[model samples]
Target: GNATMGSGVDKHALERSSYEVLTGAADIRDAITKAEQAGYDLLPANADLTAAEVELLQMPQRERRLREALNSINGRYDYILIDCPPSLNMLTLNALVAAQSVIIPMQCEYYALEGLTALVSTIEDVRDNLNPFLKIEGLLRTMYDPRNRLAGDVTAQLSKHFGDKLYRTVIPRNIRLAEAPSHGQPALVYDKASRGAKAYLALAGEMLRREEMASAGA
Candidate 1:
């Protein structure tokens, strides 16, 4: 997660958090924890991270802090997913600079569309000025309800605009998914039979398929 926002539930305790890594107070490796249940290593964040946003402004090469940190552990993982805060800020810029591609997840709503426009513009600005290789990997429609008329309309609009860049798998609104985070577990681990769990599994399959097709074409 980004340094400025906390995920509410604590995952692990660290000698040095993302805040320390960003400020050069600690090594990035010190902040990483192995989350066995979730099946991935995590760089957990906490309340201390809230101060990093303001402190980063005075630091040299501020926007590249995250990228520089990750460079030390390059090729150690298949993917490095940074969960950014809702609003754009210095932390968001660091994430943008660090990432090669962005998977944009949004609810199918009018306000979300407005936010997408701003986000796309921000991505473009970052690509031009900061990270030239940055690109939109795909757009994910989350918490989707097939029965909702507004959702269907917005989905149509997204399909028209994004074409194949919009993912075929839409994450349905499911209670189990919402409750799993509170229990400090993923939906698949909490209830694999749940709609949310199956949807995510399907999404992963779709992503793999696309990757294979891209590789073959290349």
Candidate 2:
């Protein structure tokens, strides 16, 4: 959707075999078919398991559906990534309930901190009210400008506050990244040699490392 929103990410740039699980689709089957043609396996939403079902784990049918979906993917895929929309909507609540962890994507600008307090509060509230097992996946600093003093200062502050939760790989601002989505492609496929692509790759590796640590701990 962000790609379609014209943030420069091309929808077609995703890997040929990657799956698209559209929870927001008006017609689940149609969405799945389209994604299937594009080489993605779309997920269907059952009426009983909608995002509006906030107490999903407590609802017998909803819980069963969620467990089935999660269990079904146990060995089918190496990962089951949930792309959540930016909002405190019912959908976001469902995502929080479903995910064991959350990754916060942020820029290092001074203004970035403005909403972090509220976000952190929301996370804490969610942990208390809904999912106690949830944890922060990581804090990724994206679209960074190392030369900017404000960016440098904010990075230091965030690092101090988040400690090891901050990722080592910082995603720098790149024109190529801004341009990639227009062609419906990821920066990696659009410009593999570009700095943006390299940064995202590094980020992927970092994420994998963090996940491995989490798994080992579990």
Candidate 3:
């Protein structure tokens, strides 16, 4: 999941929170903050966002609230990534409804397959019921260790099952990537030369290349 706020945020510029925007108490624009170092605009969230899960349950068109909020700024961004909590809930449903596609990142662990199965089922349901355009963009393997036999086995299985949908770039386990969140910064800003940072850069390049190929095919 993406960090809610980067270290570059100017506290003085803050006005509204993601909770307020999701709950209809504030406009999405009011919750947006510029993270100059990260080179992206962020709608920062906090613990208060948890309350929105309950509050949204009582509201009409709860699953569509986020989609409605983001429509106003749809033309401003080329990509809008919504990082949902690691669970199936109203928040995740809202994200599914709002997104065009999903990038699923997972570790090469035994339990990860089970989780992926459940997540895929959820996405299929969402696609069928809520968003017809919703699809799985790709599966990203993260924290991969080449020396681990289990990891290699899982990766091979994933490749066999997912084929081209599994990204070629794998994010190796690195200390810098793990520490970046504590510093409220990305691995690229923390240590651009680190293996983790380089892997992520490669992933970005891969994604761009895929998009170009897709466009060409289209």
Q: Count the clashes in each prediction.
A: 0, 9, 0
RMSD (Cα, Å) for all candidates, in order, is: 2.4, 6.3, 1.8
Please provide, for model 1 over 27-67, each residue's C-alpha lDDT reduced to its tens digit, 9 standing for 90 to 100: 88887876667677778787777799999999999999999
Residue pairs in clash, model 2: 8-181, 9-181, 10-181, 10-184, 10-185, 11-184, 12-184, 13-184, 13-185
Error of 2 at 77 (Å): 2.8
Give the better candidate number (1 or 2) by lDDT. 1
Q: Give candidate 3's TM-score.
A: 0.95
Question: Per-residue CA lDDT of candidate 3, range 42-158, in tens?
Answer: 888777778999999999999999999999898999888888888999999999999999999999999999999999999999999999999999999998999999988998898
Tell me the spans in candidate 2 whose CA falls farther than 4 Å from its real position. 3-75, 214-218
Q: Could you give candidate 2's per-residue lDDT for residues 52-161 as a string of tens digits?
A: 44544445544233333455456655555566656765556656776778888888866678767777888888789777988887888998988889888998898899
* Model 3 stretches astray by more than 4 angstroms: 6-14
- Scored against the true structure, residue 153 in model 3 reaches a CA lDDT of 93
| Alpha carbon lDDT of each predicted model | 0.87, 0.64, 0.88
Q: What is the lDDT of residue 69 in candidate 1?
A: 99
